[model samples]
Target: MVNLLLENGDLVVIEQSDFQQLLDVLAERTYQVVGPTIRDSAIIYDEMTSYTKLPIGWTDVQGKGTYRLKRREDDALFGYTVGPHSWKKYLHPPVSYLWRTNTTADGFQVTTAIEEPPKLAFIGVRACELQAIAAQDQVFLQGRFVDADYKARRENIFVVAVNCVQAGGTCFCASLKTGPKATSGFDLALTEVLTGTNHYFLVEIGSSAGADVMQAVTHQPASPAQIEAAEALVEATTQQMGRTLEPLDLKELLYNSYEHPQWDELGERCLGCGSCTMVCPTCFCTTTHDTIDVTGETTAHSKKWDSCFTMTFSYIHGGNVRTPLRSRYRQWLMHKFATWLDQFGRSGCVGCGRCITWCPAYIDITEEIRAIQESTNKQEEKIGGKL
Candidate 1:
């Protein structure tokens, strides 16, 4: 693999063919290749063979609370923003069997479940996703109670981050200070460069493992002009986001606006179907249950994704604290924008906009924040008038 400095001064370039070959080599080494593909007219992550399965000439139109697919002028793989799915599907599965129990002469015997970590090569991961992974790392890996299952899978995974060349209308990653360019927590990073004369990807190695993969591929040294083009592409995407969040002190804003009227407005339209939490990359709440087969002799316990919007989520001994729809809505928003930072040292929402797009009622978080800001301004005006 040829390595040359690009104009960005921080990036390196590898030929597109070389990048494709590297995936083949990783698969040969027992990595399950995961990347973006066109599924049901939207870009979703799935197992891929080579680069042919990637979403080509596909881009998404995202708004405050809408998403649509549109054709692109050229066949550029990884051309779209995130869809309903994220890398969490593979890293942390929807449902997993923790263990099993069997009836025995002595009563019952429990067998602990053993999981073998699958070596994974995640292709086309975006900057915000990398940040989400890092945030989850703090929760599952570094906490007092470490999740063995999550730890095993995380250790065997390899990340390949892609600098976003296009932004969705619902995206506020720039306002959240998360994306448009990958900063860390990846093995390799790629920037897709498409120009009038040349179409290639500028690659950069983030670790020794990525460097080894680069060595096996055939590549030519990247020129400075190519690097500049890639940087410009990322910059343009950052500027193109359709939605923006005000630069408010999130912690103070949420803490003080506990009775904001926006929550009541959202509660009326919200179905509380939990679709937003299901599609969100960072919502990790879960519930457990035990089920018996028709025979009644065999039983299994399972855990599945859960959300704060549900009535049972806030259940106490005899009643639920957040019984009202407005309270549930406020809990969700406050947890995401305020308490999560205190608990996890990061915002729970990654600004991916999946919640906005997937919500049937089209509730936009950015717009909600702006409404709160407007309300706060009016409240301050009334206090001044009283004085």
Candidate 2:
């Protein structure tokens, strides 16, 4: 396979034909091949035994309030945008057992939990997802208390990233400056190139492990023309993004917008159902609860995903801190765009737009931001006139 390093120091690529062979080899090594596939009319990640399991000849159309699948004339793998699932399900897990308690002669004893490591090869990873992974890393790994469970799964994963050839209507990664092309945190990267008479992939290797995979595949050296073609594809996709966020100073803007009236308007339509947080790739909040069987002999404690929209999320000693729907909406938006920067040195949003697509009431974050900005500007103009 043509082995060229891209601008990112941690990704590699292989030709389409050779890529199939690489997958077979990785499978033999016992690494579970997880990639996108067509299921229930949408592209979702599942166990892939071979290249046939990939979502070939399929693409998706995504918007602020809609999503649908379309068939492509040519067979191409990794041609779709991000779906409802993310790598977090595998790494963080929706539910996990912290520990168990048992009755002992003297008292109750708590037993430590044991987790097995699974070798994972994640295929067709997008640029926004890479950033999402990085954001979770901060929450679970780099914090004061590192999550042992998350750390183990993350350490065992091998990422195969794909540069977006087409952007979803709901995507705003370009505005967040997180995607359209993978810049880091990948072992390999690929750009699928399709022309009138040819279909192939331009591959680049980012890590030693990725180079080892390339050694197993048969490929030819990429020419200058192919490299140029790859660059042009990325540029076109970047320009095709359907949603855009303004270039205001995000942190200052959101912090100053706490009292904005748009929050109340959005709250009226919001169901407070928390679907957006569930679909979001970067949301990492969770809550814990205990359960007992009917026999009363068995008990278990579990941690499940949680959202800021829930009143319990903001529970103080006596009552919830943010009581009104407007306050809850304001809290979620401000934390994502402003406070997240202060905490992680980056915005919590990767611009995947799941927040817009999956919301039951179709609350569009981009439109909300614009409305707030306009209202704030008008208020400022009136104040200046009075002065």
Candidate 3:
């Protein structure tokens, strides 16, 4: 092992073999190392005991309501874009118990389930994903009422970010300034450099923990040439994005288009299956459930992910509010692009584009927003003509 003290923001180069050793080191330190792996014909995050488990020599093709896995020309591990899964699945789990009540001998006892959060080492996190995690941090941790479970899981994780060298067919992170290159929010960031007969990773240490991990790996300070090569690769990827969104005053646009006919058009196409929310990294809405045993002596209360697309999501004592599919769809899009800013002081979208790729109806958020803009402009022109 090449032992050396490394400071935050220091860039280093490590051979592909040494990258495997880094995974071994994390395992030795008792971290449940999870990363992207080919599973069920998709790149999903799961327990990866070896570096070889990474989606090596494989990339994905994504489009509106379409996704597939294909082989890459070279053995590049981190060559793909974000897939159906996000890091939120681990940090803010789909299901968890809040508390439970039971009929005890004397009286009813309400007890909370105390489970230790896993010490997770997340590998292959993309740039937009880092922003998604940050957005969730604001919702669960920085809010007035902090979620204890999310906080516990978030505080005990190590992030290994990967810079994208190629954009997916549905990606628009460049427009949102959320990715194509990871700037922060990672313990270590990696840029894969693949030259003929050479393969290495440009690793950036972003925290003391990352530097400590580097001490056990065989690596050296990257030369000026190597650093320049890595930067050029990321710079070129910026122009290769498959889609782009005009980062205009989207908040004001959505706020004013509340009664626009575009909602009805989208409602006709949207399946209301909630696939988009399930795949989205920043959409965090949940509902609670109570499970009781046969004797009704024990009751377990648990929370699971929910979606505004569901009619029951806005249900009240009288009946399900937002009964029309148009209203439900309108509420979802408006909340994401408008009300979210008022609530979190930032846009909820990170431009990962999973929602576009996973939608069965081929619905695209960028396209929908553009349609709204066009409709509004046409209405203004018509009124001006009358004037």
Question: What TM-score, over all chains together, does every model reach?
Answer: 0.94, 0.94, 0.97
lDDT of 1 at 327: 89
**Which predicted model would earn the best TM-score?**
3
Which candidate wins on lDDT? 3
Write one digit per residue (lDDT tens) for candidate 2, span 195-302.
786677777777777767666667666678887898899899899888988746867878887777788897798888888888888899899877766766545777
User: What local lDDT score does residue 204 receive in model 2, on the 0 to 100 scale?
Assistant: 74
Off by over 4 Å in 3: 1-3, 381-387
Minimal lDDT window, size 10, model 3: 1-10
- Minimum summed lDDT over a 10-residue window in model 1 is located at 1-10
Report the error of model 3 at residue 344, Å.
Answer: 0.6
Clash totals, every prediction: 0, 10, 0
* TM-score for candidate 2, residues paired by index: 0.94
Candidate 1 segments exceeding 4 Å error = 3-10, 385-387
The residue pairs found clashing in candidate 3 are none
Name the candidate, 1 or 2, with the larger TM-score value. 1
